[model samples]
Target: MTDFLHLLHHELLLSLVIVCMLILKLADRGRSGSSWSNLLNVLLLINFAGGLLIEAEGSLFDGMFRSNALLHFEKNVLSLGLLLVGLLATPYLRNHKHSAEFHILIASTLLGMFFMLSAGHMLLFYVGLELATIPLAALAAFNLNRGESSEAGAKLILSSAFSSAFLLLGISFVYGTCGSLQFEQIALTVSGNPLQLLAFTLVFTGFAFKLSIVPFHFWTADVYQGAPIPVAAYLSVISKAAVTLVFISVLYSVFGALQATWTPYLLITALLTIITGNLFAMRQDNIKRFLAFSSIAQVGFILTGILGANVDSEGIVLYFLLIYLFSNLAAFGVAGLISAATGKESILDYRGLHASNPRLAWTLTIALFSLAGVPPTAGFFGKLFLLTSGASLGNYLFIGIAALNMVVSMYYYLRIVKAMFMETTAQPIGKIPTGVAPAIALALCIAGILVSGLSGSFYEHIHLLTLSY
Candidate 1:
């Protein structure tokens, strides 16, 4: 029992937090939103801290589950991201009627992601994926007051249903071909046979839906525009990070034999996703939608990195995600503050924002700079490593294309910055109050952006952890 507890301490603790939060809700049914937000934030901090303290390395449940330094590191990075989300969203949540429920849903989805990361069996992974996805549809429609939110919810549900069907069908095909669901067994048995190839394609389609890869990304912008800012932030950062973690693991391990088969396909999709995302983002007026397409472009770079198949590829991807967590969330944090206070979501509304809201203007500027992969920001290093890793495959042409798309991304990202600092509007957004929680969140994100790139130790730590995986 003690061994089980030690090995699964992160999961156990998170589950306990969920249950305790539920019991508290039952015990005090009328608690205010601010009160609930405070409690949730404190519990999330504890959960993250507990994850750090309880590290174990082993397989359990007959290898249906596993753990190691690398998986632990992934979970910790996710926990930290969620912690930041919870903190950044506090300003919006404090007055929301269902603040406790919102955090609960986010936490539940995070638990699902945990299982997805640790699953040793295909069925376990599928189960975890479903758990992670279902709650998000509800979250997308969380703003019951808005019809667009309901539409976002419907679109997400339909998309998730189709993707899940494809995933299950693919898993079935793998089972039929290999006669086992265990990742290790399948990894050992998988071949580049026609059936296995078809199966991998189906599975890749499912991941494409989750990652918001080009064609499968139609629902993203609408969902982001409709959902509450916090939910949008969670979906953009936490959800994408989780899927990317599992996607890389499955591709690099279970489908290793099919590398020759998938590389060209991945290259094509990466190029298209980056180009398509950048082109679409330039035309978006809504901030959420713009970021949505921007995230799609970011995933393109991630797909490029996965082509490396080198030992350090996983660590590089993880490091990029860490940088993304800070950079993307900072952008959303500022947007949320502005939206909540001014009820403005248009890029044009931000014109001359610096004249009145200089702090937010600068925060968003730094975030945009990071997202555009501008130098001196962690994002620059993140993209450099990813592109470099992809270059290891000797596909310099593809890598070069991906690198050029970065310049395209910069134009759109800077459009927002230009509106904020350079352009002027007669009725520019006035000074908005930054609450304690959001202030801390934005400050942490800024610090992360500035300090992480300059410090080599963070990447070194991640690289060391990935050595075992």
Candidate 2:
């Protein structure tokens, strides 16, 4: 009871903050309303502080809500991602009318994600996933004036609903097979049953949808192309990370005995995701669509770590996720800034971006290079660790395919770079005044990439986190 209370306390505090923000927005029907930006910053700061407090205490109420070193690390990483999102939101919202509503929705979605990171039971995890997902659909449609935005929202909701059906069905099967919803109990029961194989397949399908693997990834590019850039960035970073964390937790805790059963599926998906995502991305003319395909390919790389499926694999996965968060966020941040500054969404619009906005162009370039797994950046090390782990596990084919994928990926990633640096501009692309907040966000991302590469301790810290509870 005490443990549940503690969990509820933290979860409720965040939920309450979001509710109050929403109410405040609603209450201010008159001309004089509160500054949504200020309210959002405060709310995010409070949530971040609370996450830190939970981390400091090491564990909470009891085992049901415990916070180990690994959870603490993941929580901090998530908080940092939220902070960057907040910083990116401020300028983007300043020009829009329903800024307050947007902030409140983002806050609510983030609140759900916080709970997800520490979720101990299947029911809690499912609730958190839904909470995190439902609001995002609305956010995707926030720019109702835009046709693409509306389409994005509709697609997101539809895709999420499909995934949810799979998730619920999988959960039912697991409960029927194991007679329990707790991960530990499920783990014990999974070791000895033929039915467990089907259950695992169902659960893997749900997660694969979230991860946006091939066949399950048809919705990704369309949604990214249609949604607002900030929302797209949020989906790319926060949503993906949360789902990956949940997938890792389930595999580690509830299905360790079924590793052999699942590895082949993961491998095949990884191979196809890499091939299809890269080939698809190579033909894209829209920047957002290109990135959408790029992200799908990155998910393929992440699966390699999952295939390793050991204590060390957790560290590998976390480190790669951190590197990905920074690299991918920086890429999207720059793209959002450009889109907002110039209402241009297509790759051709950026023909001569370097001539006018050299800083933004270079930032985008660095980000893209990192995405392509170029060396001297965080992504290189991230892919290196993933390959190292897979090779050590004797998954040589997986490693080889990942290596081939990187090479194939480089062609498309470099197309963006070549457009920015090599091509001549039709019209001079002027820079909007880069504010302190967005600049800081970009700097932090760049620093994370550089520091992660230079520091051995970064890898060591992730190694420590990979250990099982």
Relative to the true structure, how large is the alpha-carbon lDDT of every model? 0.91, 0.81
Best-performing candidate as measured by lDDT: 1
lDDT (tens digit, per residue) of candidate 2 on 1-469 = 5544443444666677778777877777542222566567677778777756643333443334444657766866887787788777666777678887787787777767766777777877788788888999999998879988999999999998899898888889889988988766788778647667777888888888878988799989989998888889899888898789878888877788887787788888988888899999999999999999999999988887777876688789889999899999999998888787787878888878888888889888888988998998888989988877777778676688789889999999998889888998657568666777789889989888889987889988778656645
TM-score of every prediction relative to native: 0.99, 0.93
Candidate 1, residues 240-333: lDDT per residue as tens digits? 9999999989998889989998898789889999999999999999999999999999999999888898999999999999999999999999
Q: After superposition on all CA atoms, what RMSD does each candidate show versus the true structure?
A: 0.9, 2.4
| Residue pairs with backbone atoms closer than 3 Å in model 2 (clashes) | none
- How far residue 172's Cα lies from its native spot in candidate 1, in Å, is 0.4
- Which 10 successive residues of model 1 have the least lDDT summed? 89-98
Q: What alpha-carbon RMSD in Å does predicted model 2 have with respect to the real structure?
A: 2.4
Q: Tell me how many clashing residue pairs each candidate has.
A: 0, 0
